[model samples]
Target: MISETMESHKKDSPSDIKCGIITLSDSLKEKGNEGIEEDLSGQYLFERLSEKYEVSAYVLIADESDKLIQAISNMNSKGIDVIFTTGGTGLESRDITIETLVPRFDKVILGFGEEFRRKSFEKLGSGALLSRSTAGIYNKTIIFALPGSPNAVEMGLNLIYPEIGHLVKHARK
Candidate 1:
Protein backbone atom coordinates (compact mmCIF):
# COMPACT_ATOMS: atom_id res chain seq x y z
CA MET A 1 0.00 0.00 0.00
CA ILE A 2 2.77 2.42 0.95
CA SER A 3 4.78 1.53 -2.12
CA GLU A 4 1.76 2.18 -4.32
CA THR A 5 1.30 5.56 -2.72
CA MET A 6 4.94 6.44 -3.37
CA GLU A 7 4.58 5.32 -6.97
CA SER A 8 1.53 7.50 -7.41
CA HIS A 9 3.34 10.49 -5.94
CA LYS A 10 6.35 10.18 -8.23
CA LYS A 11 4.44 11.78 -11.07
CA ASP A 12 3.03 14.70 -9.11
CA SER A 13 5.78 15.37 -6.59
CA PRO A 14 7.25 18.72 -7.40
CA SER A 15 10.84 18.77 -8.49
CA ASP A 16 11.33 22.40 -7.54
CA ILE A 17 9.94 22.06 -4.06
CA LYS A 18 10.12 25.29 -2.10
CA CYS A 19 10.72 25.32 1.63
CA GLY A 20 10.84 27.91 4.41
CA ILE A 21 12.93 27.96 7.56
CA ILE A 22 11.72 29.87 10.60
CA THR A 23 13.76 30.40 13.74
CA LEU A 24 11.74 31.32 16.81
CA SER A 25 13.76 33.19 19.38
CA ASP A 26 13.58 36.37 21.43
CA SER A 27 17.17 36.67 22.68
CA LEU A 28 18.86 35.90 19.39
CA LYS A 29 19.19 39.14 17.47
CA GLU A 30 21.51 40.37 14.74
CA LYS A 31 21.64 44.17 15.00
CA GLY A 32 19.58 46.28 17.37
CA ASN A 33 15.99 44.89 17.33
CA GLU A 34 15.32 45.11 13.65
CA GLY A 35 17.12 41.98 12.46
CA ILE A 36 17.79 38.43 13.60
CA GLU A 37 20.83 36.57 14.85
CA GLU A 38 22.97 33.94 13.11
CA ASP A 39 20.39 31.31 14.04
CA LEU A 40 22.57 28.22 13.81
CA SER A 41 19.61 25.87 13.96
CA GLY A 42 17.84 27.68 11.17
CA GLN A 43 21.04 27.76 9.18
CA TYR A 44 21.40 24.03 9.63
CA LEU A 45 17.90 23.61 8.28
CA PHE A 46 18.68 25.77 5.27
CA GLU A 47 21.80 23.82 4.39
CA ARG A 48 20.26 20.38 4.79
CA LEU A 49 17.04 21.22 3.00
CA SER A 50 18.79 23.12 0.24
CA GLU A 51 20.29 19.86 -0.97
CA LYS A 52 16.83 18.65 -2.06
CA TYR A 53 14.47 21.64 -2.08
CA GLU A 54 14.67 25.34 -2.84
CA VAL A 55 14.62 27.37 0.34
CA SER A 56 12.27 30.20 -0.58
CA ALA A 57 12.08 31.98 2.79
CA TYR A 58 13.93 32.17 6.08
CA VAL A 59 13.15 34.41 9.05
CA LEU A 60 13.66 34.80 12.76
CA ILE A 61 11.03 35.91 15.22
CA ALA A 62 10.22 35.99 18.91
CA ASP A 63 8.45 33.26 20.90
CA GLU A 64 5.20 35.17 20.87
CA SER A 65 2.33 33.09 19.45
CA ASP A 66 1.04 36.00 17.40
CA LYS A 67 4.40 36.51 15.80
CA LEU A 68 4.72 32.82 15.02
CA ILE A 69 1.28 32.78 13.47
CA GLN A 70 2.05 35.86 11.41
CA ALA A 71 5.31 34.41 10.17
CA ILE A 72 3.63 31.14 9.22
CA SER A 73 0.82 32.93 7.47
CA ASN A 74 3.31 34.97 5.47
CA MET A 75 5.23 31.85 4.50
CA ASN A 76 2.08 30.04 3.46
CA SER A 77 1.23 32.91 1.14
CA LYS A 78 4.54 32.48 -0.64
CA GLY A 79 3.49 28.99 -1.82
CA ILE A 80 5.89 27.20 0.43
CA ASP A 81 5.58 23.41 0.40
CA VAL A 82 7.06 23.00 3.85
CA ILE A 83 8.09 25.11 6.84
CA PHE A 84 10.63 23.98 9.40
CA THR A 85 10.67 25.83 12.71
CA THR A 86 13.33 25.59 15.37
CA GLY A 87 13.00 26.51 19.06
CA GLY A 88 10.24 27.11 21.60
CA THR A 89 9.34 23.42 21.91
CA GLY A 90 10.21 22.97 25.56
CA LEU A 91 8.33 23.16 28.85
CA GLU A 92 9.47 26.71 29.53
CA SER A 93 6.96 29.55 29.64
CA ARG A 94 8.15 30.79 26.26
CA ASP A 95 8.17 27.32 24.71
CA ILE A 96 4.86 27.59 22.96
CA THR A 97 5.63 26.59 19.37
CA ILE A 98 3.82 23.27 19.64
CA GLU A 99 0.87 24.85 21.42
CA THR A 100 0.65 27.65 18.88
CA LEU A 101 0.85 25.52 15.73
CA VAL A 102 -0.94 22.32 16.69
CA PRO A 103 -4.40 23.82 16.97
CA ARG A 104 -4.07 25.29 13.51
CA PHE A 105 -3.26 21.94 11.89
CA ASP A 106 -5.73 20.48 9.42
CA LYS A 107 -4.06 17.11 9.90
CA VAL A 108 -1.49 16.12 12.50
CA ILE A 109 1.30 13.69 11.59
CA LEU A 110 1.33 11.98 14.96
CA GLY A 111 4.00 9.49 13.88
CA PHE A 112 6.55 12.22 13.28
CA GLY A 113 6.36 13.42 16.86
CA GLU A 114 6.31 9.89 18.22
CA GLU A 115 9.27 8.76 16.16
CA PHE A 116 11.16 11.95 16.92
CA ARG A 117 10.80 11.36 20.64
CA ARG A 118 11.80 7.75 20.17
CA LYS A 119 14.98 8.77 18.37
CA SER A 120 15.57 11.59 20.85
CA PHE A 121 15.38 9.20 23.76
CA GLU A 122 18.15 7.06 22.32
CA LYS A 123 20.48 10.05 22.32
CA LEU A 124 19.30 12.06 25.36
CA GLY A 125 17.65 9.43 27.54
CA SER A 126 14.86 10.79 29.73
CA GLY A 127 15.69 14.32 28.73
CA ALA A 128 13.92 13.64 25.40
CA LEU A 129 10.57 13.82 27.17
CA LEU A 130 11.11 17.51 27.71
CA SER A 131 11.31 18.07 23.97
CA ARG A 132 8.04 18.72 22.17
CA SER A 133 9.20 18.26 18.59
CA THR A 134 6.24 17.67 16.27
CA ALA A 135 5.01 17.78 12.66
CA GLY A 136 1.67 18.41 10.95
CA ILE A 137 -0.12 19.74 7.90
CA TYR A 138 -1.76 23.17 7.68
CA ASN A 139 -3.11 24.93 4.61
CA LYS A 140 -1.57 22.24 2.40
CA THR A 141 1.85 22.97 3.80
CA ILE A 142 3.80 20.66 6.07
CA ILE A 143 5.15 22.23 9.29
CA PHE A 144 7.61 20.79 11.76
CA ALA A 145 8.19 22.26 15.22
CA LEU A 146 11.64 21.24 16.42
CA PRO A 147 13.60 21.86 19.58
CA GLY A 148 16.07 24.76 19.71
CA SER A 149 19.15 22.61 19.64
CA PRO A 150 20.93 22.23 16.35
CA ASN A 151 21.25 18.51 17.00
CA ALA A 152 17.50 18.16 17.25
CA VAL A 153 16.98 20.00 14.01
CA GLU A 154 19.38 17.70 12.17
CA MET A 155 17.88 14.55 13.63
CA GLY A 156 14.32 15.57 12.99
CA LEU A 157 15.06 16.58 9.43
CA ASN A 158 17.01 13.44 8.72
CA LEU A 159 14.04 11.38 9.83
CA ILE A 160 11.44 13.32 7.91
CA TYR A 161 13.25 14.23 4.70
CA PRO A 162 12.36 10.93 3.11
CA GLU A 163 8.64 11.52 3.43
CA ILE A 164 8.39 15.27 2.76
CA GLY A 165 8.05 14.91 -0.99
CA HIS A 166 5.25 12.39 -0.68
CA LEU A 167 3.49 14.38 2.02
CA VAL A 168 3.56 17.57 -0.01
CA LYS A 169 2.33 15.77 -3.11
CA HIS A 170 -0.64 14.24 -1.27
CA ALA A 171 -1.47 17.47 0.49
CA ARG A 172 -1.63 19.38 -2.75
CA LYS A 173 -3.84 16.72 -4.31
Candidate 2:
Protein backbone atom coordinates (compact mmCIF):
# COMPACT_ATOMS: atom_id res chain seq x y z
CA MET A 1 0.00 0.00 0.00
CA ILE A 2 1.08 3.54 -0.68
CA SER A 3 1.46 5.90 2.25
CA GLU A 4 -1.44 8.17 3.11
CA THR A 5 0.82 11.18 2.86
CA MET A 6 1.65 10.21 -0.69
CA GLU A 7 -1.98 9.57 -1.57
CA SER A 8 -3.19 12.84 -0.10
CA HIS A 9 -0.49 14.77 -1.90
CA LYS A 10 -1.59 13.26 -5.20
CA LYS A 11 -5.33 13.62 -4.75
CA ASP A 12 -6.75 16.42 -6.91
CA SER A 13 -3.30 16.92 -8.32
CA PRO A 14 -2.89 17.62 -12.00
CA SER A 15 -1.26 14.23 -12.57
CA ASP A 16 -3.73 11.65 -11.38
CA ILE A 17 -1.39 8.77 -12.26
CA LYS A 18 -0.91 5.73 -10.11
CA CYS A 19 2.07 3.42 -10.80
CA GLY A 20 3.63 0.13 -9.81
CA ILE A 21 7.30 -0.81 -10.29
CA ILE A 22 8.54 -4.33 -11.00
CA THR A 23 12.19 -5.36 -11.19
CA LEU A 24 13.05 -8.55 -13.11
CA SER A 25 16.23 -10.52 -12.55
CA ASP A 26 17.21 -14.13 -12.06
CA SER A 27 19.98 -13.77 -9.48
CA LEU A 28 18.17 -11.10 -7.53
CA LYS A 29 15.17 -13.23 -6.67
CA GLU A 30 17.08 -16.42 -6.01
CA LYS A 31 20.45 -16.86 -4.27
CA GLY A 32 18.60 -16.35 -0.96
CA ASN A 33 21.23 -14.11 0.64
CA GLU A 34 22.44 -12.13 -2.36
CA GLY A 35 21.18 -8.57 -2.40
CA ILE A 36 20.00 -6.81 -5.54
CA GLU A 37 23.19 -4.88 -6.21
CA GLU A 38 21.97 -2.92 -9.19
CA ASP A 39 20.43 0.47 -8.66
CA LEU A 40 16.69 0.48 -9.31
CA SER A 41 15.89 3.03 -12.00
CA GLY A 42 12.17 2.37 -11.65
CA GLN A 43 12.36 3.17 -7.95
CA TYR A 44 13.97 6.51 -8.70
CA LEU A 45 11.35 7.28 -11.31
CA PHE A 46 8.55 6.24 -8.98
CA GLU A 47 9.83 8.63 -6.31
CA ARG A 48 9.79 11.51 -8.75
CA LEU A 49 6.31 10.60 -10.04
CA SER A 50 5.05 10.36 -6.48
CA GLU A 51 5.28 14.10 -6.22
CA LYS A 52 2.06 14.36 -8.23
CA TYR A 53 0.87 10.79 -8.74
CA GLU A 54 0.17 7.92 -6.41
CA VAL A 55 2.64 4.99 -6.40
CA SER A 56 0.76 1.83 -5.59
CA ALA A 57 3.49 -0.80 -5.24
CA TYR A 58 7.07 -1.88 -5.98
CA VAL A 59 7.95 -5.52 -6.57
CA LEU A 60 11.08 -7.51 -7.53
CA ILE A 61 11.04 -10.95 -9.11
CA ALA A 62 13.17 -13.48 -10.95
CA ASP A 63 13.62 -13.88 -14.71
CA GLU A 64 11.54 -17.01 -15.04
CA SER A 65 8.68 -16.74 -17.55
CA ASP A 66 6.11 -18.10 -15.17
CA LYS A 67 7.10 -15.69 -12.41
CA LEU A 68 7.03 -12.71 -14.75
CA ILE A 69 3.61 -13.69 -16.09
CA GLN A 70 2.20 -14.25 -12.65
CA ALA A 71 3.53 -11.02 -11.23
CA ILE A 72 2.31 -8.98 -14.18
CA SER A 73 -1.12 -10.61 -14.03
CA ASN A 74 -1.33 -9.98 -10.31
CA MET A 75 -0.46 -6.32 -10.72
CA ASN A 76 -3.00 -5.89 -13.49
CA SER A 77 -5.67 -7.51 -11.36
CA LYS A 78 -4.87 -5.02 -8.61
CA GLY A 79 -6.03 -2.22 -10.90
CA ILE A 80 -2.76 -0.37 -11.03
CA ASP A 81 -2.86 2.56 -13.40
CA VAL A 82 0.59 1.81 -14.80
CA ILE A 83 3.37 -0.70 -14.36
CA PHE A 84 7.11 -0.20 -15.01
CA THR A 85 9.21 -3.32 -15.34
CA THR A 86 12.97 -2.94 -15.32
CA GLY A 87 15.43 -5.54 -16.65
CA GLY A 88 15.20 -8.77 -18.65
CA THR A 89 14.72 -6.98 -21.97
CA GLY A 90 17.92 -8.27 -23.48
CA LEU A 91 18.73 -11.04 -26.00
CA GLU A 92 19.81 -13.55 -23.43
CA SER A 93 18.03 -16.90 -23.40
CA ARG A 94 16.62 -16.25 -19.94
CA ASP A 95 15.14 -12.97 -21.05
CA ILE A 96 11.55 -13.96 -21.55
CA THR A 97 9.86 -10.93 -20.02
CA ILE A 98 8.54 -9.81 -23.37
CA GLU A 99 7.35 -13.27 -24.30
CA THR A 100 5.41 -13.67 -21.08
CA LEU A 101 3.88 -10.20 -21.35
CA VAL A 102 2.92 -10.22 -25.05
CA PRO A 103 -0.15 -12.45 -24.68
CA ARG A 104 -1.45 -10.33 -21.83
CA PHE A 105 -1.42 -6.92 -23.48
CA ASP A 106 -4.61 -5.41 -24.87
CA LYS A 107 -2.57 -3.39 -27.34
CA VAL A 108 1.12 -2.89 -28.01
CA ILE A 109 2.70 0.53 -27.87
CA LEU A 110 5.24 -0.12 -30.64
CA GLY A 111 6.63 3.40 -30.61
CA PHE A 112 7.84 2.92 -27.09
CA GLY A 113 10.48 0.44 -28.20
CA GLU A 114 11.40 2.57 -31.17
CA GLU A 115 11.77 5.69 -29.05
CA PHE A 116 13.60 3.93 -26.30
CA ARG A 117 16.16 2.54 -28.72
CA ARG A 118 16.50 5.87 -30.45
CA LYS A 119 17.20 7.61 -27.17
CA SER A 120 19.48 4.88 -25.91
CA PHE A 121 21.43 4.79 -29.14
CA GLU A 122 22.62 8.32 -28.45
CA LYS A 123 24.41 7.00 -25.40
CA LEU A 124 25.20 3.35 -26.14
CA GLY A 125 25.63 3.35 -29.91
CA SER A 126 24.68 0.09 -31.63
CA GLY A 127 24.12 -1.62 -28.29
CA ALA A 128 20.71 0.00 -28.01
CA LEU A 129 19.40 -2.04 -30.91
CA LEU A 130 19.68 -5.16 -28.81
CA SER A 131 17.10 -3.87 -26.39
CA ARG A 132 13.53 -5.10 -26.76
CA SER A 133 11.97 -2.42 -24.60
CA THR A 134 8.22 -2.06 -25.06
CA ALA A 135 4.95 -0.82 -23.59
CA GLY A 136 1.23 -1.61 -23.83
CA ILE A 137 -2.15 -1.64 -22.17
CA TYR A 138 -3.24 -4.65 -20.12
CA ASN A 139 -6.42 -4.91 -18.12
CA LYS A 140 -6.58 -1.10 -18.25
CA THR A 141 -3.04 -0.85 -16.91
CA ILE A 142 -0.24 0.64 -18.97
CA ILE A 143 2.73 -1.74 -18.82
CA PHE A 144 6.23 -0.69 -19.87
CA ALA A 145 9.16 -3.08 -20.31
CA LEU A 146 12.50 -1.38 -19.77
CA PRO A 147 16.05 -2.56 -20.24
CA GLY A 148 17.72 -4.05 -17.21
CA SER A 149 20.47 -1.50 -16.87
CA PRO A 150 19.96 1.50 -14.59
CA ASN A 151 20.88 3.88 -17.39
CA ALA A 152 18.30 2.32 -19.70
CA VAL A 153 15.71 2.54 -16.97
CA GLU A 154 16.49 6.24 -16.62
CA MET A 155 16.00 6.77 -20.34
CA GLY A 156 12.70 4.89 -20.42
CA LEU A 157 11.28 6.75 -17.43
CA ASN A 158 12.31 10.16 -18.69
CA LEU A 159 10.50 9.52 -21.93
CA ILE A 160 7.40 7.75 -20.58
CA TYR A 161 6.60 9.35 -17.23
CA PRO A 162 5.46 12.66 -18.66
CA GLU A 163 2.55 11.11 -20.56
CA ILE A 164 1.73 8.27 -18.19
CA GLY A 165 -0.80 10.30 -16.23
CA HIS A 166 -2.83 11.11 -19.29
CA LEU A 167 -2.46 7.60 -20.64
CA VAL A 168 -3.74 6.02 -17.46
CA LYS A 169 -6.67 8.40 -17.22
CA HIS A 170 -7.68 7.59 -20.78
CA ALA A 171 -7.16 3.87 -20.34
CA ARG A 172 -9.53 3.84 -17.42
CA LYS A 173 -12.16 5.65 -19.39
Candidate 3:
Protein backbone atom coordinates (compact mmCIF):
# COMPACT_ATOMS: atom_id res chain seq x y z
CA MET A 1 0.00 0.00 0.00
CA ILE A 2 2.72 2.44 1.00
CA SER A 3 4.83 1.63 -2.06
CA GLU A 4 1.89 2.11 -4.37
CA THR A 5 0.95 5.30 -2.57
CA MET A 6 4.48 6.63 -3.01
CA GLU A 7 4.63 5.43 -6.61
CA SER A 8 1.58 7.53 -7.42
CA HIS A 9 3.60 10.65 -6.70
CA LYS A 10 6.61 9.52 -8.67
CA LYS A 11 6.34 11.74 -11.67
CA ASP A 12 9.07 12.70 -14.06
CA SER A 13 11.26 15.66 -13.07
CA PRO A 14 14.63 17.05 -14.13
CA SER A 15 17.58 16.07 -11.98
CA ASP A 16 19.88 19.02 -12.53
CA ILE A 17 19.50 20.04 -8.91
CA LYS A 18 22.08 22.41 -7.44
CA CYS A 19 23.45 21.91 -3.94
CA GLY A 20 25.25 23.78 -1.17
CA ILE A 21 27.52 22.37 1.51
CA ILE A 22 27.79 24.00 4.91
CA THR A 23 30.05 22.85 7.73
CA LEU A 24 28.96 24.06 11.15
CA SER A 25 32.00 23.63 13.31
CA ASP A 26 33.33 26.31 15.61
CA SER A 27 36.83 24.88 15.57
CA LEU A 28 37.05 24.87 11.77
CA LYS A 29 35.34 28.23 11.37
CA GLU A 30 38.09 29.74 13.50
CA LYS A 31 40.41 29.16 10.55
CA GLY A 32 37.87 30.44 8.07
CA ASN A 33 37.56 28.87 4.61
CA GLU A 34 41.26 28.24 4.78
CA GLY A 35 40.33 25.49 7.23
CA ILE A 36 39.05 23.33 4.41
CA GLU A 37 41.91 20.95 4.99
CA GLU A 38 40.46 19.85 8.31
CA ASP A 39 36.90 19.61 7.01
CA LEU A 40 37.05 16.01 5.85
CA SER A 41 33.33 15.33 6.14
CA GLY A 42 32.32 18.47 4.29
CA GLN A 43 34.96 17.86 1.67
CA TYR A 44 33.61 14.37 1.22
CA LEU A 45 30.08 15.67 0.83
CA PHE A 46 31.23 18.24 -1.72
CA GLU A 47 33.15 15.72 -3.78
CA ARG A 48 30.40 13.14 -3.80
CA LEU A 49 27.56 15.58 -4.39
CA SER A 50 29.44 17.36 -7.13
CA GLU A 51 29.41 14.22 -9.23
CA LYS A 52 25.65 14.23 -9.87
CA TYR A 53 24.65 17.73 -8.78
CA GLU A 54 26.29 21.05 -9.15
CA VAL A 55 27.80 22.26 -5.88
CA SER A 56 27.01 25.96 -5.98
CA ALA A 57 28.46 26.88 -2.61
CA TYR A 58 30.69 25.35 0.03
CA VAL A 59 31.22 27.17 3.33
CA LEU A 60 32.57 26.62 6.81
CA ILE A 61 30.80 28.41 9.61
CA ALA A 62 30.67 28.46 13.38
CA ASP A 63 27.83 26.68 15.17
CA GLU A 64 26.21 30.07 15.62
CA SER A 65 22.69 30.80 14.40
CA ASP A 66 23.64 34.03 12.68
CA LYS A 67 26.27 32.29 10.62
CA LEU A 68 23.90 29.49 9.75
CA ILE A 69 21.14 31.89 8.64
CA GLN A 70 23.58 33.84 6.56
CA ALA A 71 24.87 30.75 4.82
CA ILE A 72 21.36 29.59 4.00
CA SER A 73 20.51 33.01 2.63
CA ASN A 74 23.53 32.93 0.38
CA MET A 75 22.59 29.49 -0.88
CA ASN A 76 19.02 30.57 -1.46
CA SER A 77 20.23 33.57 -3.39
CA LYS A 78 22.01 31.23 -5.74
CA GLY A 79 18.81 29.22 -6.11
CA ILE A 80 20.36 26.14 -4.62
CA ASP A 81 17.97 23.20 -4.71
CA VAL A 82 19.28 21.59 -1.54
CA ILE A 83 21.55 22.50 1.36
CA PHE A 84 23.54 19.89 3.28
CA THR A 85 24.89 20.93 6.67
CA THR A 86 27.46 18.74 8.37
CA GLY A 87 28.47 18.85 12.04
CA GLY A 88 26.84 20.34 15.14
CA THR A 89 24.20 17.60 15.33
CA GLY A 90 25.82 15.59 18.13
CA LEU A 91 25.28 15.76 21.91
CA GLU A 92 27.81 18.54 22.40
CA SER A 93 26.65 21.91 23.72
CA ARG A 94 27.84 23.52 20.49
CA ASP A 95 25.60 21.26 18.45
CA ILE A 96 23.20 24.01 17.43
CA THR A 97 22.54 23.23 13.76
CA ILE A 98 19.31 21.28 14.29
CA GLU A 99 17.99 23.59 17.03
CA THR A 100 18.68 26.75 15.08
CA LEU A 101 17.25 25.49 11.78
CA VAL A 102 14.23 23.51 12.99
CA PRO A 103 12.16 26.51 14.07
CA ARG A 104 12.59 28.01 10.63
CA PHE A 105 11.56 24.89 8.72
CA ASP A 106 8.41 25.24 6.68
CA LYS A 107 7.99 21.46 6.77
CA VAL A 108 10.10 19.05 8.76
CA ILE A 109 11.05 15.74 7.12
CA LEU A 110 10.77 13.66 10.28
CA GLY A 111 11.59 10.34 8.62
CA PHE A 112 15.09 11.54 7.84
CA GLY A 113 16.26 11.71 11.42
CA GLU A 114 14.39 8.63 12.45
CA GLU A 115 15.72 6.47 9.65
CA PHE A 116 19.21 7.85 10.02
CA ARG A 117 19.23 6.75 13.65
CA ARG A 118 17.82 3.36 12.78
CA LYS A 119 20.50 2.78 10.15
CA SER A 120 23.21 4.08 12.43
CA PHE A 121 21.98 1.92 15.29
CA GLU A 122 22.81 -1.20 13.30
CA LYS A 123 26.44 -0.12 13.17
CA LEU A 124 26.81 2.04 16.28
CA GLY A 125 24.56 0.43 18.81
CA SER A 126 22.86 2.85 21.25
CA GLY A 127 25.31 5.63 20.52
CA ALA A 128 23.41 6.29 17.29
CA LEU A 129 20.60 7.82 19.33
CA LEU A 130 22.93 10.63 20.34
CA SER A 131 22.95 11.98 16.80
CA ARG A 132 20.35 14.65 16.15
CA SER A 133 20.54 14.76 12.38
CA THR A 134 17.50 16.28 10.68
CA ALA A 135 16.08 17.38 7.32
CA GLY A 136 13.42 19.91 6.27
CA ILE A 137 12.15 22.45 3.82
CA TYR A 138 13.21 26.04 4.46
CA ASN A 139 13.00 29.02 2.15
CA LYS A 140 11.87 26.58 -0.53
CA THR A 141 15.10 24.64 -0.24
CA ILE A 142 15.69 21.23 1.29
CA ILE A 143 18.15 21.33 4.19
CA PHE A 144 19.71 18.22 5.65
CA ALA A 145 21.59 18.53 8.92
CA LEU A 146 24.07 15.70 9.39
CA PRO A 147 26.72 14.76 11.94
CA GLY A 148 30.33 15.97 12.01
CA SER A 149 32.26 12.75 11.74
CA PRO A 150 33.43 11.57 8.33
CA ASN A 151 31.78 8.19 8.74
CA ALA A 152 28.46 9.70 9.74
CA VAL A 153 28.56 12.14 6.85
CA GLU A 154 29.28 9.29 4.46
CA MET A 155 26.30 7.32 5.73
CA GLY A 156 23.99 10.30 5.69
CA LEU A 157 25.04 11.32 2.21
CA ASN A 158 24.56 7.80 0.89
CA LEU A 159 21.10 7.63 2.42
CA ILE A 160 19.94 10.94 0.98
CA TYR A 161 21.77 11.32 -2.34
CA PRO A 162 19.47 9.08 -4.33
CA GLU A 163 16.39 10.89 -3.11
CA ILE A 164 17.69 14.45 -3.12
CA GLY A 165 16.36 15.36 -6.53
CA HIS A 166 13.01 13.74 -5.82
CA LEU A 167 12.79 15.49 -2.46
CA VAL A 168 13.70 18.85 -3.99
CA LYS A 169 10.85 18.58 -6.45
CA HIS A 170 8.30 18.55 -3.62
CA ALA A 171 10.03 21.30 -1.66
CA ARG A 172 10.15 23.50 -4.73
CA LYS A 173 6.44 23.92 -4.35
Candidate order, TM-score descending: 3, 1, 2
Judge candidate 3 at residue 142 and give its lDDT: 92
Question: Of the pair 1 and 2, which is ahead by lDDT?
Answer: 1
Compared with the true structure, the alpha-carbon lDDT of candidate 3 equals: 0.89
Q: How would you order the candidates by lDDT, starting with the best?
A: 3, 1, 2
Tell me the tens digit of each residue's lDDT in model 2 across 32-130. 434344436656766776877787877778888877777777777877788888888888898888888888899898888899889888888998779
Q: Is candidate 2 or candidate 3 better by lDDT?
A: 3
**Candidate 3 deviant stretches above 4 angstroms:** 1-11
True-vs-predicted CA distance for residue 90, candidate 2, Å: 0.5
User: Comparing 2 and 3 by TM-score, which wins?
Assistant: 3
Kindly report which residue stretches of model 2 are placed more than 4 angstroms away from their true locations once superposed.
1-14, 31-39
lDDT per residue as tens, model 3, 58-138: 999888888999999889989999999998887777788988999999999999999999999999999887989999999
**Could you give me the TM-score of model 1 versus the true structure?**
0.91
Q: Alpha-carbon error at 147 in model 3, in Å?
A: 0.4
Model 3 clash pairs?
Answer: none
lDDT of each: 0.87, 0.77, 0.89
Which candidate has the highest lDDT of all? 3
**Top model number, TM-score:** 3
